[model samples]
Target: MRKATFIIPAIVIVMAIIMSSVFIVDERQRALVLRFGDIRSEIEEPGLNFRIPIIEQIVLYDSRIQSLDTAPIEVTPSDDRRLVVDAFARYRIIDTRQFRLAVGNGGLREADRLLEDILNPQIRAVLGADGVTSNTILSSDRAELMQRITAQARVLAEPLGLDVLDVRLKQTALPLQNLEATFARMRAEREREATDERARGEEAAQRVRAQADRTVVELVSDSAREAEIIRGEADAERNRIFAEAFGQDPDFFEFYRSMTAYERALTGENSSMVLSPDSAFFDFFAQPGGRAPAAVPAPVE
Candidate 1:
């Protein structure tokens, strides 16, 4: 009974030790074996691993690409205009041993802090370079600026065992202090454009109205000239007909003209004419039977 008890307990203890000595490094992880809190060996390939039980410790780190978002930072370009820029970075750990040595137990957190510290200056340096204006930073050329920033930050990040794959500006905007000023300037420009367009429209309207008025004036003047010509032609035709009638009968024509004058002069209420009874004007009234007056011969030319 005692042998059986001792053997069973011994077997259980050995199994526990074996289990403690063996560790599995996942495919997505890189591991470091530590002895006495100092790094001894790095396991980059994913597979079964072994460590001395109760003496060696293992640390695992993700080897995949990671992302870091930076806080919005203020930048002043060469144009002296202030802008707020938000940026992000994509990076990966190429050397796990160097990363573990550099960051120790703080691991990725400490590395992140250092990365941010490196990024800030690089961002400011590349974005604030001489002759780099705010317009360029906000434009598509910002991609070029980011490339330069990534290149510069990569150099600084090498010491941290971090390979910076890319750095990009996510948002670029004017500071609050300059926003109102920019809006005012834009509004003024739009207003000036509107005014110019309105002036052009008014000028065109004036030209159209002037042309219409000229057309109407020309039409009315032509009509008036034509009417005057028609009236003059009708008057000449009537005078010619009267001349023919007078040549045919001289006395009768004189008598007829005298009667027409008398009818016109005697018309209307209270019409009066002061003349002698033997006056030639009464010749028509004196002859009731239409008696002819003495024939007057034509005058010599």
Candidate 2:
């Protein structure tokens, strides 16, 4: 009975010591052995690790890529244009020993705080370099700007055991006051363009109207000249026909003219004319026996 008790207690004590000495190193993490707060060994591979149970301590840190979302910060570029910038970065703990020594047991949280401090100053410095404008930040050069920021931040992050893989600008915008001013300027420019277009349209319309007016004047003048020419030709033709008819019968022409003159003298009911009895105009009326007037002799040419 005494041997059984001693052997059972010894086995139980050995099992407890073995369990306390052995630690697990996960694939996603790296383990560091610290003896009295001094780093002694670094376990990078995932496997079983041994440490003095009561004297040595282990601190585990994630080895995977991590992200840091910084707060929105104001940056002024070379053009003196102030902008609000929100940025993020992807980084990983490259050196576990340096990370623990520099950041302590604060882990990812401490690294994030330190990264923000390093990132913000460099953002202001590189973005504010000569000839880097706000347009450049919002345009095709935006990728270049982020590259510069990442490269600069990587150098500063080396001592902190961080490798800055990439830096990206999430949002870049002007302040509310500047936005309103830009809108006003854009509105003014559009209004000016519209005004110029309207003026050009009106000028073109005026030119068209002037051309139409000139065409109308020329057309009317041509029509009036053609009508006058036609009238003159018709009058000459009628007179020539009358001359031929008169040449055929001289006495008949005289009688026809006397009758036409008598009709005119007695045109209307209220028309009256006083004339001498011997007047040649009364020849038709005085001849009651239908006597004809003497024929006029043709003059020799």
Using TM-score, give the best candidate's number. 1
Clashing pairs in 2: none
- Candidate 1 structure quality by residue, lDDT tens digits, 1-301: 9999999999999999999999999989999999998888999999998999989999999999999998889999999999999899999998888888788788888888889999988999988999899999988898999999999999988888899999998889999989999999999999999999999999999999999999999999999999999999998997898799999996677777766676667899899899866566665567765643443233222
Per-residue lDDT over 100-217 for candidate 2, one digit per residue giving the tens place of the 0 to 100 score: 9889978899999999999999888878889999999889888998999999999999999889999999999887778988889999999999999999999999999999999999
TM-scores for all candidates: the values are: 0.81, 0.77
lDDT of each model, Cα atoms only?
A: 0.88, 0.87
